[model samples]
Target: MTPSATPEPSPAPVLVLMATLNGGPALQEQLDSLSSQQHTHWRLHVSDDGSTDGTLDTVAAFAKAQAAHGRDVAITSGPGRGFVANFLGLLAGVRDDPAFVALCDQDDVWLPDRLQRGVEALSKGPADQPGLYCSRSWVVDQDLQNPRISAAFPRPATFGNALVQNIAPGNTILLNAAAAQLARAAVSAAQAVPGLPAHDWWLYQLVTGAGGLVIWDPEPTLRYRQHRSNQIGANKGFGATTRRFSAMLAGRSRSWTDANLAALRGAAHLLSPESATLLEAFDRARRGTLWVRLTAPSKLGIYRNGTLAQAALLLSLALRRL
Candidate 1:
């Protein structure tokens, strides 16, 4: 008799970290989407920030249903400070786990292949080196209609670009084991600093600063739903452009820069030597005179995405607003 074939082993599980606050009915669709991922070996941990809109009940129901399917779903009380803290706290709790980590949004509808694609892409990199996988998303209206793709970055993802702008959206980010460990180690310092930018932005900076690999997949991986309750909306279209430019002029971008620099400084020991030097240069450039500001971008290789964005960055430096 012929010998029986060996069974294929299942893929390594992914830890899906979601932060929620008053998610209401929208959270249900997001939960359903998570249940339908092509990569079935995922465990979800939701951090709810004192939701009074039945969000906890919704999570409980989803958790009970998923449990029956042999999937592990857990919930924890969030820090109640805000979404940023809640996410960082969730990431901090990921101590020593070997699974890849995916940051999820409470309102976005993920495509079925989201986890599968991320896992496949991250698996190609060296196991010891940190790898961050991020992709474009189809920005849809509240009902998931009127789809529009997010912007594409023409240049490479580097620490320089990350210092001033974030190309990696949080909802679509997946970190391999190495990157997850790095992030887990850095969260305490990040959490200690107040007013830090979004968790995704900090991750981009932290990974690139540490000389890790950043994989930018051109494919759209999820439906980024835009609604009145979105903390951060899609970064596309003239309206979005105008809003960003206005924010830069209003010194809001400057505040974010300050916060990011402070947090990066708190974790300076983890940065690569070259990245450390660049960070110092960028910090000086932000505070130097007009000529230094004008020359900083070319010298430090600091950049944003497109021509228009580069122009805005220059203008912000000139105006001392960024």
Candidate 2:
């Protein structure tokens, strides 16, 4: 008689954190995509920021359906501050849990292998060391059609690069146990700071600053839907470039940089000594004279993604706008 085949081991659990604020229009599609993930070992925790719409109803129905499959979904009332605060609060709530954490946007459609790819990439690294995996996305219109790949950043992901630019899109970020722990430890400090620019940018800085491993996969993992109501849309093409430059010229970059630096300083103890020193140097460079500002990028070894962006950064420094 033939012996029964061995059962496959269950995959590691991942805690997916999603922050929502009136995301009803496309929430169902996003939930369906999450249910379709190839790696089924995931639990979802959504923090709603006072949604007056049917977002909670959609989540409840999804939760009821998923419960039958042995998957769990939890909902919580957010801080009601904003998306940044809502995400930070979610991170704080899961600070003690050892499962891998993934940030999800309310409107995007994740591919089936999204969790599998991120989990596999992060699994190869040392368990004690922080590991963050982020991937490119296929930019799609509101209806998920007219797909085009997001711009690729070939530069190395480091603390220095994260100080000036954010390449890791939040929707695609996956943090291993160690990295999630680090983020949880620092969430309180981050929440104390007002107007923290973006949680994804802060995670990019925090992971790299703690000397963590960052894997930037070039393959597209999800459909990044661009619509009129998106909090942050796709940043590609000449029109977007022009808008970015214009924003910088209008001193928006400086404001964002200020907020980021303040938030980072509040969590300075969580960063490595080397990263702390680099952060201080960059902070000082921003406060220096015109000549110092002009030479700061090369001296501090901070950079953006492409040559055009790098040039624009230099110009912003020269104009005292960054």
Candidate 3:
């Protein structure tokens, strides 16, 4: 993604795609972060999920201003689709020859090296393993007072694990064209499976399930924000987010239930045959047909890998807290 490597007319520009809703509060901070990215050879495409607020107008103005300033920023209407659909639609809309596609959120602030580092990682794998390269993030808030993070990235990830639980946040995802093609195809094929999770997390599973690769870079290259209006669960500190999750479990927050469960089931189905031991344990634990409940500790941790122990720990905590 060097500044001088121009798109040779035959292809579409390397694009940065963002799916935004009522994100007006921190839109400019996101825009500025992109503007300051270390790589300058990319174009920006936005799919607005019908923002009732000034979100759409703000992005329009920002693009226009950037255009006036000679930067490559573009905006488009998203037909009022929700977050997941708009994300899929935006990437699918990229009919142009895309070398790579990066996901951006309107609220998070990215470090300057995200795109550049991701490009390097993808380059190492080549078209053979074109899944996605993602890094961990420093989960923060608007004020950036408290940052909660773990050494989660640069860890082993595959389709099986990904289907069960998302490893990297969406904002840290960067995929090459071949991987993007595979992702689009998987989404189209998953029509039968309607209740999937976030498009970013789902795409990671899809690409890997198709025999692609996922590489983690371990660096916290993005600032993930948490707020009361979060669509899913927010990324508070280990203690804080966990305590809040226990509360949500008590309340049985609908959004969190739908998103997380769908993620678990989907990830479970992606396990390879070689992963049958872990896979069987995960599926049985997740499957509700049985009288028993799942409580596996994921190989990764208490929350990830969709293991029986992790699930059990979560339920145990919830039961105690509730």
Candidate 4:
């Protein structure tokens, strides 16, 4: 008798954490794109932050359809804090599940190979070590037309760069199992602070500060939708960039830095020795005199994205702004 062929072992499952808030306009398209991912072994866990629109219903219907097709899907109410808290809650919900995690936005259209590329990139690294994978994205209008590639950062990503600028966009991020665990451990620390500038930035800080490996993919993987009602739009043009610089001068960036430092200090036990030292020096420089602030960033290796950005940082220091 002919022997029956043995079934192939299934790929490791991935958990996608999507946070939604009034996403009715283009939520279905994003869901459809996710359903089309080449990496099929992914479960989508969506958390809605009290949407007054039909966002939750749309997600619920999508989950039902996916479940009927034998795919794992779930929906839940968010913490009502904000997007950052909503994402943190979802991360906490899957703490011990031992699955790869990807952060998803309700308004972005992921490419067919988004999950596949992330898995392939992460699989090359040491599985036992914490690792984060992030990539560039294509900025598009609401209709997903007129695509423009986001600006590339010439310098390598480091905790130094992460201190002031977040090069990694949340929509294009994927974390290995180890990295996700580290992030979960910091959720309480995040809640201890009054506010977080951005969840992705906090993850970048936590992962890098804990001596984890961070990979930056040069290729674009998703459509970052720009709309009038977006909480944070595709910050691409000169006007947006100038406004960001102005915020630094207006002490908003300094306030964000203070908040991040407080959160990190609360979780000091989790950081690597080197990272702890660096964080301390950064805080000291923030409160130092004009000359100290001017020279301390360079001495401490704290830098921004580009040369112009670095110059602006120095200017902010001289003016006692950052």
- The candidate scoring highest on lDDT is 1
| Prediction 1 TM-score vs. true | 0.98
lDDT of 2 by residue, 151-270 (tens): 899999999899998999999999999999999888888888877889999999999999999999999999999998987878799878987888888888899898888888888998
Cα-based TM-score, every candidate: 0.98, 0.96, 0.74, 0.95
Candidate ranking under lDDT, highest first, comes to 1, 2, 4, 3
| lDDT assessment of candidate 1 | 0.93
Top TM-score model: 1
The better-scoring model by TM-score among 2 and 4 is 2
- Looking at candidate 4, what is the lDDT of residue 294? 90
Query: How much is the lDDT of residue 132 in candidate 4?
Result: 89
Model 1 pairs whose backbones collide: none
The candidate, 1 or 2, that scores higher on TM-score is 1
Please, what is the whole-model Cα lDDT of each candidate in the order they appear? Answer: 0.93, 0.92, 0.65, 0.86
Error of 3 at 151 (Å): 5.8
- The lDDT of model 2 is 0.92
Off by over 4 Å in 2: 1-7
lDDT of 1 by residue, 215-234 (tens): 99889999999999888999
